[model samples]
Target: MKTLYIVRHAKSSWKYSGIEDIDRPLKKRGIKDAHLMSKFLSKEIARPDVFISSSANRALHTGIIFCENLEYPLANLQINRQLYSFSDGYLVKTVYALDDAFNSAIIFSHDHGINTFVNKFGNTPIAHVSTCGIIGIKFQEKHWKNIKKGKTFMVEFPKNHK
Candidate 1:
């Protein structure tokens, strides 16, 4: 089986208005929530075989925190530039291109795209995935390319921890 872990990037700070959207960093709350969610995931699920994330500042930071909490090496995380935009189709295409050697993978990205992707593939319904939110979908197929619809088995958000 192949599993896809969808992680929405934590809340980013608008304090740096002068900076571009891609450069926005996570706020204090975002940092704390990222750690919390990561801890929650560590206890609730198995570690992902690979980690992929958008190169944007907030997304990358969130991925790094989760990696640290999961005891996964930061050097192993893969970055994709297209993930910075709201492109769910492209995101899925990237997942399809993943090496079949990895059974499970986590993707850290921004919303609209992430939110839409989950609702599309997930069997459960969700209005929106909050900051630091995580949704896991399990596919019956062995290869990433063969994965189409999957059963949504995991849904986690900041409030669940609080």
Candidate 2:
């Protein structure tokens, strides 16, 4: 089986007006929440074999926090620009193209696309995925290429636990 952990980047700060949206950093609350979520994930789920994330500042920072909490080495992370504003199709394609050596993977990105991807594959009915929220989906297939929509065995979101 393959597991996909879809994590939405933590809330960003608007204090810096001139900075581009792609360069916005996380807020104080976002940092706390990222740490909390990371602790929760580390205790509840097995460490991901692969970590993929958007190159955007907030997303990359969130991924770093997650990796820190999970004890995943920094070298294992793959920062992909395509994940910055990926559509559902693009997200799925990216997942499908993952190396088969990885049995579990984490995708740290923004919402809308993450929401659409989870809802498409896992039947989640959320309106907005909270900052630092994680949705875990289990696929029956052994390889990522064999994964398909509506084939998820479970979906776990942070709000659902709270």
Every model's TM-score: 0.97, 0.91
Q: Candidate 1: deviation at residue 113, Å?
A: 0.6
Local distance difference test scores for all models: 0.92, 0.84
- Candidate maximizing lDDT: 1
- True-structure lDDT of candidate 2: 0.84
Report how far off residue 110 is in candidate 2 (Å).
0.8
lDDT of 1 by residue, 52-113 (tens): 99999999999999999999999999999988878698778878999999999999998889
In candidate 2, how many Å is residue 54 off?
0.2
Off by over 4 Å in 1: none
- Residues forming the 10-long window of minimal summed lDDT in candidate 1: 85-94
Q: Superposing all C-alpha atoms, what RMSD in Å does each candidate have to the true structure? A: 0.8, 1.9
Candidate 1 positional error at 81, Å = 0.7
